[model samples]
Target: MIQTDGAFGRPTRHAPPLLNARHAEDYWQQATRCIDLVRRKMASVDRPFTGAHPEELKRLFEGIDLDAPLGELRPALEELERVYLDDAVYFHHPRYVAHLNCPIVLPGILAEAILAPINSSLDTFDQSAGGTFIEQSLIDWTANRIGLGQDADGVFTSGGTQSNLMALMIARDHYGAALADHGDNKHEGLPADYRRLRILGSEVSHFSLQKSAAILGLGYQAVMPVACDDHFRMDPAALKARLEECLAMSLIPIAVVATAGTTDFGSIDPLEEIAALCRAHGIWLHVDAAYGGGLLCSRRYRHRLAGIEHADSVTVDYHKTFFQPVSCSAFLVRRRSDLRHVTHHADYLNPLCQAEAGTPDQVNKSLQTTKRFDALKLWLTLRIMGADALGEMFERVIDLAGEAHDELARHPAFEVLLDPPMSTLVFRYRPADLCETELDELNAYVRAALSRNGEAVIAATRVDDKRYLKFTLLNPDTRLEDLTAIVERIVHHGRAWCEAQAPTRAAAS
Candidate 1:
């Protein structure tokens, strides 16, 4: 009832052939065509987004038939280019100050090209070979940069979210192991008093910590939020007070998740102070440096993360700050043996005997088994552009942020948040004629309108229940003038929307 293609179209006993050398030429041609289109799009100084509305996209996608392949490479590529590539948001554009996305370096792109064809699964030495070593080397390099001792070790993860999850998992297991007669939480679920186990994090910390607690059976209530200071950094005094309160209530504080770079405010918590507090309380310190990790190589800004070295574990997202592609992040621990908390031996994948016999398997440490070789992207980036070059780029963005902050502060139409600790600037357009409620609505409307028009892509967030726009300046080449234009456009839209609402508000009043 089935048919298999044979050589010269003759029937044969063999099954359908897998893609190998026989398809290499065709594959190369198709891949290069896609790459060429991407290169052109990246180079173009056009709108950051296509501003395609949801209804329009729904209508467009309805025409696509998924049951049958296009068969011809050229037609498929043309269709993709028309439907997707044309509407794709271009982070490399100078006006795109939207999120944590970065303009990837050339070496990272080239590394992707190489890795796609090889398709190496970086779980075991037998499968990855040199890939295992490369990933290990990167981990070692990152740990050393953090001043994590020689016993330090880590594994590449999907991104910051997964890295944070893995860090909390390790902390939970380590804490559980210390409890009376509770060996491993992985083998045995949390003890009967799991409700008392809690994770302490700043109010501004990423939401992943709470998610991790929920996933680890600790419940979202297990995460206690510590207050932050005037500058949005976690207040060490508040953290100490919370820890004492937890102790007084007979609650077990398993870990202190200090944020090196928070998402909205770009606030770097007082790492040195937090590290000392965690040390005194004997709490595991996991620093989520997903955004600020680039400061590791930044000669000028590296001091901002001075006490990161004291962390028990650190989450670094190279994709966010190192100009690498997505999914290039690692969760590092101070002691190599601590990673054993996540290890499991499988006869088919990694056997205990093979590990004992000196075989290096990355899966032993990672939450993921068949992981992508994302380390190669950062490796190639560092090799092609020296660490200092990357650092310089980071410095440029930080400097740009400072300039933009001053410019926004001077503008009467905008109310800038605390001076940026990193490259993100959070501000809201406050028109003189509008009240607090009206200003919030106006700012929110401005963000949506700009996105719908696709003139300049920016980010928006709420601070203290009031809407504020955020400019995440990750592009080193993004200048003050570009940001000024974006701000002007935001103001323009805010004013227009407010004026339009005036008649309706008067009628309602």
Candidate 2:
């Protein structure tokens, strides 16, 4: 029980300050202990998430209270240490091969810890004078990478989803000029004379684009998915056909979204060919390079993203491929004027003088006003590690994925899909004497077993109406041996499941 001064058996003083000196000291000591524990954990951890122990977690949070005193929290804190700090899967661990989240370099995290507490808003120059310069510098660097000229401008977004949404907003406002001033016109219903607007992208284009279309009053049907070739790339010929059909229907092609690297497979569409189509059709070209933007670091791989220069806008997620922490993404445009489509003003929030002073006011370009200074994390990442090192890390993950694919293909128990275009590998466990249906069932079993055992966390997706396990290689520390071990576990579990079901399967057969 906490000791408190009382008058007439009632607490005389107000409740203890939330963070008094004693509590602060206690927290500091606990934090120090946590740091030491983390260092020790990091040394031994390989795959943190999948390798996590769940029973440990249940016990940790069993009866923790929200309003508990600091002294009372000691037990819960100890419990948290027992489960999360000790048993949780560490992405920093070499064996973690689950989600798209990368093991962020320490420098980036350190910068965030400092900068976030200060809470600098990048919305305007008055709010973030030096921060504006930092953000612009990073945008310029990214623009140059996309082959957008020196005149190009951009702003850091929350992530790829925000970037994609901004791209659609610009495209829609440009094509449907009247709609910009009259969003209410949609409720009034699209004008009888309004030209039919459409967005074209590969079938595998990020789902965010469809949502963007819906938000813009274009309806989900406004997005037309073009055909993809065997490589899962947007087939230029098919896209041309779709555009021609739209033209025949008197529908205006507002924007053509070409994926630099798709989410499932790292497939790069034929960008140069698609760029030509956009030029000829006079439609906006927005490259969703959210997944493959890191390829800019690889001289050899950079060529795959050709025609990015011809694009009007591009969305790149630095967090995805650049090893930055989450929410660091940028949306860039070839011409700065296009940003005017989204520009808004209010006298109270952004006075005319501040706007007219020629300040680097990011609010004029951003969708949000009170934006966090997300640029510092990227800035610190580039400064401490340099672009070359970061690029090498990007290359390393892709190389590891390629190597794992080949090794998995050679193993008789596993069937690898066609080679990865970039880094993601799609494959499944195979058992002897199994038909196509049985094989699919066994693969499903393997995936479930991996999840239940908490030995490794892997993702699964369907291609061509068939399911396969997927590993999106984002962690540089994940090695070939680690993948091999995962495969072995998958096979072990799959074989056991198959054997257990053997009698029933035979009867059905």
Candidate 3:
């Protein structure tokens, strides 16, 4: 059924779709109104954002009474449109190349419609039933895609942050178990020399690893930063040196976290070499493939994650690259037994008796007790649109990044970073006359000016304490011309800012 509210707000049904059959029609009618609100909003959206400031939106909500209800769905939606939807950032727009967020597929949205109404919680078999199996099936499929062997197992997670945290927790427990002085930190508490435990990651790796270190009771100090190469990949030589240094200092190197894709540069670590280093030291290997994990869907780019199969644990965020909605991600492990670290037998929930009966209790190996059936979105998406089709789409974005990087390098006024291993480009405007300090200010001003005018949305980051702009090209619909137009706007704003500062420069001279 095509969902539409069109130019009219008339009810399309007379009943609700859940619980009572009597109100089924009403539910579809109300659902259509909400769907059409989004449909109209996206269809009409010409810019990535509305340039609405915080104070402007705050004024819109200040006069509203939260206690009072509109008593009708239409009015409530109308109020939402005015306060939220109107000013909300449209990630689906082609110019929205700021973050890793992707334009979701229709199949995933349809899955959301079915899953939301039923609201199946995947904590236990009784609650989720078929949902548990569907999630497990997808986990198996993802494991196979990663070339993880038969013993591989995993559970769905909220996103990459939680997944990375889970990986580190398992690493901590697994490593702690082998130590003579440290034993079972999960239940027995941290060992006396827990301060000696260390986790190594690239300098360019996700911040989640440090956050995970803090959460694991190892303190942020436990994280050792390994240096990266010029292109921003974890240098294997640097990692080997760090490992030897840790051993020389009598510190316990618990794990090596290799980033498959660095956040800013889209650089993949030399995973094959890194895996070899982890194997040599018998250290737990955890690959944070959150951004590049989508390559698993691409037949052409699958080899980019060559050594991911060697990881003890891996974090993949479907929301980032798989084109799934938020809260859809998974944490995979090479050995099913490694999950014993995260397992807990709650008598009221997933009891030991259930395990004895050979029941699949997902909560036994999950960080979350109450979890949504997010796997359904992936399952339905794969079923309707084959993995090959999705892989082709991912390939397009990867190809687009290479083209943009080369084109950007030819631009005299801008400094484009190295070609991305995936679909991201880091560049900055550098006018000939400005000093290094002034270049930073000019690029930052351009980013803000574009957003201020609602012309285009671009992201900014700092490389070596110098400001730079970045393009995260996740949307396949975003073409070269669209990016070229954004570049024109950037140059426009940069020149304008320079001209406005001419008076100040003259006064300083």
Candidate 4:
């Protein structure tokens, strides 16, 4: 409780002053202790989750005074532990192969330690002097990696979703500009037939494309999903057909969105062939490489994303593949001039004269203002550990996926899907005695049981209305032995469920 200096017992809302030169020692002591608390918790953690039920946890936070302070950092942090840290999901655990979350590298953490205290905002040159230039350098380097050529330029975004949205937004305005004679399409708003403008994406592409279309005044239906081949990759022939159909129906194809790495299947579309189709149709080609962009660092697997250089725009999530922390992603364009669509000038912020005077205000490059110094994390990651080291870590996981796939296919009780083009594996448990109907329930039970026990955690998804399990292998430290143990636990729980149901079935029969 805060010390009450008032004459009465009434509580005061204020506790402490803000950090400044006088508070340097206080900040140092508090920050160190807080970081140590997390370090100890993380190091001592055994499982990915604590299996804490939602309702049970919600009760802990049921009633708290809105205006109250513990008056000390230690007490507040201790309270936070009870509600959050104690039961928080630790993605660093090798058994937590449920989603795209990756364990961060040490250099990224070190960079965060520095950036948090400085609190630099990257919106303008005056705000973040060296920060703006640092970000520009990283963007240029990433564009070079993607082979986007000399005219390439981009800006850091929150994540894949924001990056994809910006890419689609640019595609929309760029097409609208060409359609008109002489005017800024963005200022005049979407074209007269904006409803008819469609974006073609692979059937297995990220759902963010549809969300982006909806946000850009086009309905969700504006995103037309083309067919995929048996390998779960976008069929180039199918894409060609869709493009021709768009012309026949008098529907303008604003962009052809090809996925370099799909979410569930990890299958890469035929980028070169799709680029050809986009070129012939005079459509903007945007590649959503959020999952597979790490391939740029690998000389071995870089060929997989060969034709990405031809893309008019691309999205890459460094947090996902490069082992950086969350909210580190970039949206790159082939031509630097294309970024003018999202550029907005304000006298108080980035005025037109600032750009003319060659002052680098990142607000002109991004749709967002007051963005974080997320680029610093990536910058430090590359500086401390070279790109090759990150690539090797990524390569290890991809190799493990191939080995895991082969083992799952050979195993009698599991049904493995296509071989991953990157590092995610989609599969489900299937006993020979069970049919599809029983298998769905069993797989769902297995996933839930593992999660409830707090031993291992995995993912579940639906494939064409058919429920299946998934293993998104992003941890380099996750050995086959660990996967074997997870598989065994899944089998044990599934068999238990089946045995319990057997008595009911026999009695009914």
Which residue pairs collide, candidate 1? Answer: none
The C-alpha TM-scores of every prediction are 0.96, 0.88, 0.96, 0.96
Clashes of each: 0, 5, 9, 0
RMSD of 4: 2.9
lDDT of 2 by residue, 153-233 (tens): 999999888899999888877765544555533245454434488899999889998889888778888899999998889
How well does candidate 1 match the true structure in TM-score terms? 0.96
lDDT of each: 0.88, 0.80, 0.90, 0.88
- Look at candidate 2 and give me any clashing residue pairs: 46-95, 47-96, 48-89, 48-90, 49-89
Best by lDDT: 3
Q: Output the TM-score of candidate 4.
A: 0.96
- What is the per-residue lDDT of model 4 for residues 463-493, given as tens digits with 9 covering 90 to 100? 9887888888889989998898999998899
User: lDDT value for candidate 3?
Assistant: 0.90
Q: How well is each residue in 1-509 modelled by candidate 1, as lDDT tens digits? A: 34433222223355233447754655666567778877787677488887888787777677688976665556777788778888888898888898999998889989998887799999999888999999999999999888999999999999999999998999988988888888778888887788899899999899998789898888899999999998899999999999999989999999999998999989999999999999998999999999999999999989999899999999999998899988799999999999999999999999999999989999999999999999999998888898898889999999999999999999988899889989999999987877888888888888888888887888989989988999999998799999988888887898789779989989988
Which prediction has more favorable TM-score, 3 or 4? 4
